[model samples]
Target: MSLLNGIFPKMKMTRSSNQSTIVSLADKEYKKDRPLVKMCGITSARDAAKAAEAGANFIGMIFWPDSKRSIPLPIAKEISRKRWFLAGGVNHMNVCEALSILRPHGIDVSSGICGPDGIQKDELQILSFMKAVHSVHY
Candidate 1:
């Protein structure tokens, strides 16, 4: 087996001790305070549906071919039917163009937010994008 495969024990349920079980329950209650948004790049539609059912506010569907999370627009459209936010590749230079087409509730961008390897947002670009969206009637 591959090193990654061996390390993860595919689809195996974690055996939680009593203390761990109590911690998990407590964590669930704590998470109720703020809506958590999860970006799933490695999950199938069924798994994404489960996340939606569990109260995820956003579900990302990668459209960048270079990413392992990349999925076709058709599949993304199909899986994005639930109430959760649907967002895909909003990092490319043509992101605004794509947004015009997909019309997702919100767009997510990381690399596009800054220079390569940078950790912060490019304030000017961010403001421009936000302003543009605000100008739109929808």
Candidate 2:
């Protein structure tokens, strides 16, 4: 098993499952009024700043060359101080370990929240993902 799967074995979900079915095994309840939200695949400084202004807890810089949303390192550095997360193919499976290792202010997601089309962000999936993440005590 991959290291992430080993660390967070419960993150896996079948494609047949509904968006609401994605759950986490976190035993602790997050009491915070709102967990930090990080929007990934930011391509421009204007968009990055806009996300920050819109109350996004963190911005994500995509460094993976395979990702359509990937940005150059220089651009990433420009917005490095804006409370950001490094993201590309981040998902529920690796999020727990990523949080454990990086311990950033928040985590970001993209394809994880998308529908089968892999483009449109599904509201139900987003809600479920958020719920799972927020359920973590840490």
Candidate 3:
């Protein structure tokens, strides 16, 4: 708590389930000099990059099970970068194509990199999958 002592009265980005954007409840002193913006439910890096490009100071990764925008861990990590966020039916077999054609903000995976039970993440599959993505030129 001491870390935030001087900056304790910080503003917060409030959100609701059905919304894609964040609303910062200010403390009157909030200035346009660098308003804090957190782009929520970012599913790709492109979107994140775009948000960053637009002056967003932070990002929110969506992973709520019942929320329509819930993203898989692998995909979230992928987009947690600067650009490109791709999802929907992506897997090892087709990741290369997605990267070559679509490009990264990052890829979201569930069954694509999961074990047989479709719950636990398969490490080798995750590695191989990210390797395939990283191998792409652009």
Candidate 4:
């Protein structure tokens, strides 16, 4: 089975160390909160829907073909109701223009947010990217 399918099983049973069982996502009830969250590297619509139902503020669909997590535009478009960001190769240089065109609720980045090593996440780079994103009205 695919990673997405495994992550979003129809019914999941979790047993705690105390031997208490936790209800599945389908059976659990929740009180909503206002924190905005985004699920990145989603490859399937089913997973996207599950993320939306679980209260994600945004879902990320990586469009860069080079990334293993990339999802096709058609599949990404199939997911609706929840705001989503297109990630992969997104950086400060093109973020504003991409935001203006895509108009997603937010954007996501992995490599673009990394430091000189191109792997480790850079706090300063992330902050700068956020500032750039916030500067755009839309």
**Per-residue lDDT for 31-137 in model 1, tens only?**
33354555557236666645545655456667767787787767665555423333444553556565555565566666555654477778876776676656545
Judging by TM-score, tell me the better candidate of 1 and 2.
Answer: 1
- Candidate 3 TM-score, true structure as reference: 0.41
lDDT for each residue of candidate 2 in 75-106, tens digit (9 for 90 to 100): 66554542356677655555555554444445
Relative to the true structure, how large is the alpha-carbon lDDT of every model?
A: 0.51, 0.57, 0.58, 0.63
- Listed per model in order, the count of residue pairs whose N, CA or C atoms clash below 3 Å is 0, 0, 14, 0
Q: On a 0 to 100 scale, what is the lDDT of residue 124 in model 1?
A: 74
Candidate number with greatest TM-score: 1
Total backbone collisions, model 4: 0
Better of 1 and 3 by TM-score: 1
lDDT of 3 by residue, 7-99 (tens): 312323434496543323223333445544556676665666566556554556655456677777676655543343455556777778756
User: On TM-score, who's better, 3 or 4?
Assistant: 4
lDDT of 3 at 49: 55
Question: TM-score of the candidate numbered 4?
Answer: 0.51
Residue 60 lDDT in candidate 1:
67
List candidate 1 stretches off by more than 4 Å.
Answer: 1-34, 42-44, 86-88, 135-137
Report the lDDT of model 3 for residue 112: 76
> Against the hidden true structure, what lDDT does model 3 obtain?
0.58
| Error of model 3, residue 111, in angstroms | 2.0
